[model samples]
Each structure stands twice: as C-alpha cells, then as structure tokens.
Target: MTTWHCLSVKPEELRLDTTLNCGQSFRWVNTGDNQWTSVLSGRIITLRQTDDDILYRTPDDNVGHVEEVLRDYFQLDVDLGELYKQWRTDANFEKKAGRFMGIRILRQDPVENLFTFICTSNNNIQRITTMVNKLCQHYGTEIGTIYEVSKPFYTFPTVARLAHEDVENELRQLGFGYRAKYISQTARYIMEHHDETWLRGLRNLPYEECREELLKLAGVGPKVADCVCLMSMDKPGAIPVDTHVWQIAKRDYKLSGLASKTLTQKNYLVIGDRFRTIFGTHAGWAHSVLFTADLRQFEHRLISSEETKSNVVLEGTKREVSQARRPKKTAGVTVFDRYPRRKRQILEGKHGIVEKK
Candidate 1:
C-alpha cells in the first residue's frame, strides 16, 4: 500500500465516517476498519484517519500529487472551525452542530453530482448507494481494488460513456427503475447540446442561475439542482429540502407556512428561504449538519423501537417480512446484482484484474 499523510487536518475539523458515509457521495465504501476506499476522477484511493491526521494510499504511483488531489476532494481548505462558530450563534444550530462537528460538504465533480442526485429522488441512502455503484460498475472503467476486500473500484462514467441509447434500457434491466431513464436522458442531452465544462461553469454563476441551468436537464428538479449547487458548485446558500429537512424546518422553526404534511414546491422554497435567513452565508452547510443530526435521531428511534419489540415472535415476523419485501432472485443473481446483456467492459486487464489505463 502506498501511503501519504495529511498533518494539517484536525480530528474535530473532519470526521471521515460522518463525512464520507453520510449519504452525500455514494462511491465511497467502508473497509470495516477505519479505512474507506473510493474512486475519484478515475483514481482509486483508500483513506483513513488517525487521531491527529488523515492518511491515504493508492496503488498507482503515477497518479501524481496525492496531497492536493485529496485536499480538494474533501474540501479540507474550508475552515470548519469558523463555520461552526458562525452556526453556534443560533440555539437550534448549536444543538445540532455539536453532535456532528467534523462533517463537511464534499467538493465533487459537477456532472457526477448532477447524475447522483437525480438517482436520489424518493430513494433511501442504501438504495441510492446500490444504484450509483451499479452505474459505475457497468458503465465506468475499472480503476483499482480495495486492498482489504479485493473488491474492484470503478470511476463514475463520463457523460459520453452514459449517453448511448443502450445505457437507458440496460440501466432499467439493472433495476434502476425510473431513475435509469432520467440519468440516460440527461446524459444524452448534455452530450449533444453542451460540453463537459458546461456544468462546471455554473460555479461562476449565481445560485438562481445555476439552479435554472441545472433544471433544464432531464429529471433534475429544484431539490436535485439545489443539491448539485450546494454540494458541488460552491453555492453554499442553496438548501435542498427533502422530507427530513422539511420536517426539521417545521418542527424546530415552527414555520407558520407549513400546514400540510406533504412538502409542495412552494413549501420547499419556504423552508429553504427560512434556513437561508437563519443560517446566513453558509446556510446549506449548516442545514446539512442539522439534517444529518435529525436523520441519525430518526434512525436511532427506529432501531430502539425494533429492539424493544424483539421478542421471538416479533423477531421472526420481522425477518419474514424483510425477506418477503426483498426482490426475488433470478438464476442465482439477486436483483441488486443484475446486469445488462453486454459483456462487462474492462479498461486494462493484467493479473486477471482490471485497472484504469
């Protein structure tokens, strides 16, 4: 393993577990130890945190200048200490921020972020992770392997790679369901009418302009566009209000506008504006921290409820229900592992392994 050290980062400034695994970016996988393996811009690297520093390893030495690459990917230049201080002036943010101190919004590739958030519609994190990884495995070039599991990592496919007609149909067969079409159509649209730099150029535009441009793509709605803006495009004020964020807004802020249980577009805007007003410049970052806290609490309550009812009968029934709801297996291939008719593409094959060329 080739290793490098990041001595500038502090434990409280960046927590790898919360930052990586918190449903923002999907390519990262936990290696069961403190390490995480992920593919970024076609380079595969494993990252782990010590008490005082963050460390990373990659197999390819010529990938070049690992320190700057990781620093940019993790957005480590952002002063989390200063942002936390700004957020703590408010009681609600103060409470939420304390629980997730080291979380920072990642600086991801814009087109990748666009397609990833499109898959996030009406989906949970587990399913989203599955879909994104499947997209990479099927369409993206294999980069390298996780040392621990020997599981190969793949890059996020370029827009050109995903723009083909067969990609849509194949993705549907691979269990992407409706999201397959969105991703496929969006890829085709960009490839025909625009260049890859089109999405990246939004960094210079205002948040509203960025959102407007993003919405022109297939399947990108306000939330998805706003997500791309906030997380990847440097629009820190942009808040993507999903159900969890909506609930947090109504419950904590007691917003008078939120009367309905469902979040309409109008309500979504209201919630976004409210948070923007409350959290000021870095509202999206603060909003994400709060949303993470709320999500964790909800998950904790769910697990506690399940454990409280874990009598033999309840446990058996839960297992039965879970199995019943799971997608049926076909010819020893479970639904999640299903692929298209085409042979899996391998970019570089050596030692019976595929790595990026």
Candidate 2:
C-alpha cells in the first residue's frame, strides 16, 4: 500500500510560480465542479473555499510519487515568513507595484517539456497551446476516452514515436508559422540521441557551463534554456528575457542603460548575470512574479483602451492616445468562398500515391 496526500490551497495553496514548468497551460479536464485532473500528471488537483488546503493523489503508475517529488523540488517545507518581511520593508523592492499574476506550474512529462519549451521561443501562450494540442492529437497515443468533452483527445507523443514522422507539413497546413521546423528538428534530435541524459547531469556545473549545454540543443536559446533550467532542473532564478521582458525591464525597472543594441546570445548571459547579482539567488523567481504582473498590466491597458471610455478631450491638436498607439493592420484582404480555385492534378489509379510532377 502507498500513501499519498495533496496539500492544497484555494488560491494560495497553489503556488503560481512558473518555475515548475513554463507557463504553458496544462488545461484541466472539467471533471464536474472545481476539481481538475492533469492527464499528463495524472493527479486530480483542485482548490477550495474551505479552511484546509486542497489535496490530490500522485499519478498512478508513476515510478515513485509525483506530488512528493514536486514538494521537495519547490522547497515547500521552507518558511517564507522572513523573506516576505524582507520584501515588505524594502522600498527598492516596490511592493505596491502591481497585482501578482496567479500561474500554476504544470507537472508535464520530461519529453513534452523539452519539445514544448523549444516551441516557445518567439511565441505566445495561445499559439503554443494550439500547437501542443495539435501535436498530441496527431502523434500521441489514443487513450480512447473523453473525460470532460463530447469529442476525443490524446496524450503527447514520445520522442521515439514522433521522430521519423513528418508532422511539420501538417503543422504548416494548420498555420503554426516557423515553429513547425523547430518542433521537427527537436524531435529528430531526440530520436538520434536515444540514450542522451547528459543534460540532467549538468546540475552541479557552473551556471554558464549548464546554460551552454542547453544552447547545444537545436531550439534551446537563452530564454528557453533558462526556462528549462529553472523549471526542469530546480534552478531558482533563471530569468528568461524575451521581447516583453526587455520592454518591461527598460520601461518599468529603469534598466534602459542596460539595454543592448542586439539581443545576441552573449547579451543574454550578461543581462541574466546582472539580474542574478541584483536580485540575489531567488532573482529568477522574483522575475517570474514581477514579469507576470507587468504583462497583466500591459494586457489590461490594451483591453481598456479598446473598450468604451469617456474622458475630456483636448481642443485643437490633441489626438486620442489609444488611437495613436494602435497597431497597424495588414492592408488588402480578400476571401473566396465558392469561387473556382486552383486544383491539384489527381491520378487516382492503381497503387495510388500522389504522383510526382
């Protein structure tokens, strides 16, 4: 017999730290009310309006235990009281700066994580989720049961499974942009190196050395590597600086002088090193909290600007700030619903594959 427990919190019980994994939403199967089960993690996680924190069982067939491994990984045993006190009193820390964005670190499988973060470079949450879902349906195992929905879905594919498959063209057909190539390359790389576990051994090496190992991978750039380091490898404060982070650090943190003419590979190391010095060991975690909050603020402002609002307008020359700030749209768009379209030459005959032109 095995014992399992889930120390759950409504909002607080769940630490919204993206350090567990990158911010890819492991969508919950709405098994009735508020309870959520990650088929990947195989844990039924939930929050409550009650006094005690929530609890969940570790996924069955797991090598050991998922939640227990997670607890130690997150250092849930440590008391944050002293740290919170330090944060509160430090004026330079900027306590009243913004609301903390609630992010849950999803317990994704190791291989899924490798490929998922690889796809995350120069991408957004919505697009990443769509791509992951598409990959799962195309390559992953058919579990043969729809828990929450009327239709069916499946788990993510293993590296061994998807390596030889040409999933990229399919992704292109589905509008994945250039990410199709990255996914294809990463899968192939994994397939080529079946016994490669050298990455996991980099834990004790110097930060630069560890980061370099990550860079050796096809799609693992600075940000993606940093995300993997922090989330997958238990590195506390590996700040993954992207375009949004570059903007926020300059505009909000007054780090404009720190800005470089290029976002080159070297610059990523320099900038990340500087922040680690500034924020101490947990700087990476701090970056996560602050970055999320800052992004939410930007999102809110954009939304508010789009919505109806009434304010006094200046007389002669003043234009609405929102109007001036709006993004430019692509010109000249057309749609042909029932029009005669270009046709592919079909030779539907014996031993039929599409014939080479």
Candidate 3:
C-alpha cells in the first residue's frame, strides 16, 4: 500500500544544491513550496516534506519498498520526536543546530552512509563529496537520464561490484589518494564477508558490537565507525567525536582543559566518558545534533587552527611534502585543537571512471 505521511522537512536554509558541484554544494535551495529536495544516496534519491509528514520517493515506482526499508532500518517510531526535543533543549545544543543545515541524515541509505563515513577520515567534506560522486558515476547502476531534475546522478556502487582489486587503482585515478586503498579493502571485506543475510544481523547486534565490527575494516577508525553506527544504526550514544566536536567538549563542556601535549584517542575517551554521564544513552546522537546546531561556532573554532593546511604524510616515503595545488575553500584546514576534520568531499563519479570520448 502507498502511504504518505509527515516524515520530516527539508529545511530550506540548509538545503544543498546537488546538481552542479557536489564537492562545494552545502548550501540550501528553496523548492518554491516552502520546501526543498535533497539529492541523497549518491544522487539516486530526493526527499521533500509537506506541512505534516515527509515524503520519501525514489526516481521510480519502488516507493513502497523504499519506504518500508526506511521505516524498518531507521526505527522512526521509537520516540524520535521526544528525542529530538530533548536534543534541542540540551545545554550544549547550538541555537541553529536542530535542523543541521537540513542535512537529512536519516534519509541516506545505511550501507552508503557507512561507506561514506569511511571516506571521511583524514579528509575534508568537499574532497569527500567529490570522491563519493565519482565512485557512483563510475561503478554504480544507472537509474535514468532526468534532464528535468539532474543531468544524471548514479546510484552508489554495490559492494559486489566494487570488490574488484582494480577498484583501488581506478579510484586512485580519480584522486582518492590514500583512501583509494581503504575503499578497496572495505569493499572487499563487505563483499567477501557480508552476505545479503548479514544485513539482518546489523540490526540485532548491539551498537558497540556493530561499531567494533565496522572498525575492523581498513581505514575505519573509531570516529568513522561511530558516525556510521549513530547515523545509520540508531546508535544513540555513538558519538563520532571528530575535531570540531572534540573542541566543543573541551572548551564548552570543560571536560578537559587545553593541554600542552598532543591529544590521543585515550584523551578523547576521557572526555567522552563525561558525555556518557550527561547525555546518557542519547549522547552519540546528541553529539551529532549539537554539532549540527553549533556548526558555525564549531567551524569558526576548527578553521582557525593551523594544521588545517595540507601536510602529506607519505605512506612509505617517510617524507613530508608540502601540498601543491589546494582547493580555494579550504576553510576546514586549521583544526589543531582537535583530531581535525579530514576535510574533503568524496571524489565525483565522473573522474577517471567515465572518460569523455
């Protein structure tokens, strides 16, 4: 049965333009009906909300299946409204945060979300987005050419298709850099180990257990795994604890005073343990909600640090080389106070994969 209900609104101020430049596309656009559409799922899906409920639709007639998947996967009925309200009231909630620039994190596919977080390590959002788009156009199934909406945005590559050894080399051709290897390894692991049936186990496992499993993949640190867990698996306390959040905890929460020494993962946990006490089971999601709220303040703090400048730590050369050509909007480069955002959107799908003939 096709049912339409109020799921959520795509906040206009935070809506992004997904057509032109996915790398630098983080601004909001008005859909003209006091609503906006987000090109999520590697540009395979778009979501908009009406006055009451959010409408989830694919580019095809598979809306029933897709809606069921979202309902079951996200557990949308589990006091989410109350949880959102609590998040809004928390002392740490940043004033403009509850909408999170209308990112619509809940709407993204779980598998893609997990894999995308893996690309986030030691990178920036622009570069990360570009890389993700590139992977899709090169590897994923084609939906159709919709000249009306987008010229075309491909679905994300399946784990089965990306498990090829050549994926590393192919992605490297797209400027994925070190993450090319990580993506290959992650693809290989999921393809070899995660059968279709295993997807069910993802829901049964405890959030910690699932996160630990994700961490086992190459290039997936605790922070990346935590982000995947919290955003996709409903791990309410699975705070990803990136550089910006780290600073907020220290400066605002005073969980730890600024120390002269280099901070370590254990140092992260010391403060995180405190959040566990304060935000409790919802701390993980709470951290995200607050992080979204205070993004301007957090961005101000992180962008002010010096290490945001690109410093390449060669895997084997053991040589530190200065970056050659840097992107213009490198605002997230200066994060010395925290672990630092690995700033960059994923590579675009067209790079190195689809060549102009």
Q: List where candidate 2 sits over 4 angstroms from the true fold.
A: 1-35, 41-52, 57-66, 69-75, 78-83, 86-98, 101-108, 144-148, 151-153, 194-206, 259-267, 297-357
Per-residue alpha-carbon lDDT of candidate 1 for residues 111-147, written as tens digits (9 for 90 to 100): 7899899999989888999999888889888877754
Candidate numbers, best TM-score first, in rank order: 1, 3, 2
For TM-score, the strongest prediction is: 1
Q: Per-residue lDDT for 237-266 in model 3, tens only?
A: 766676777777777777645462545788
Q: After best superposition, candidate 2 residue 107: deviation in angstroms?
A: 6.5
Best by lDDT: 1
Cand. 1 TM to true fold: 0.81
What are the runs in model 1 whose C-alpha is more than 4 Å off?
61-63, 297-357
Instruction: Point out where model 3 deviates above 4 Å.
Output: 1-44, 50-62, 69-75, 84-89, 94-108, 193-200, 257-261, 297-357
Clashes of 3: 40
For all candidates, the clash counts are 0, 5, 40
Better of 1 and 3 by lDDT: 1
RMSD of 2: 17.3
Candidate 2 vs candidate 3: the TM-score winner is 3
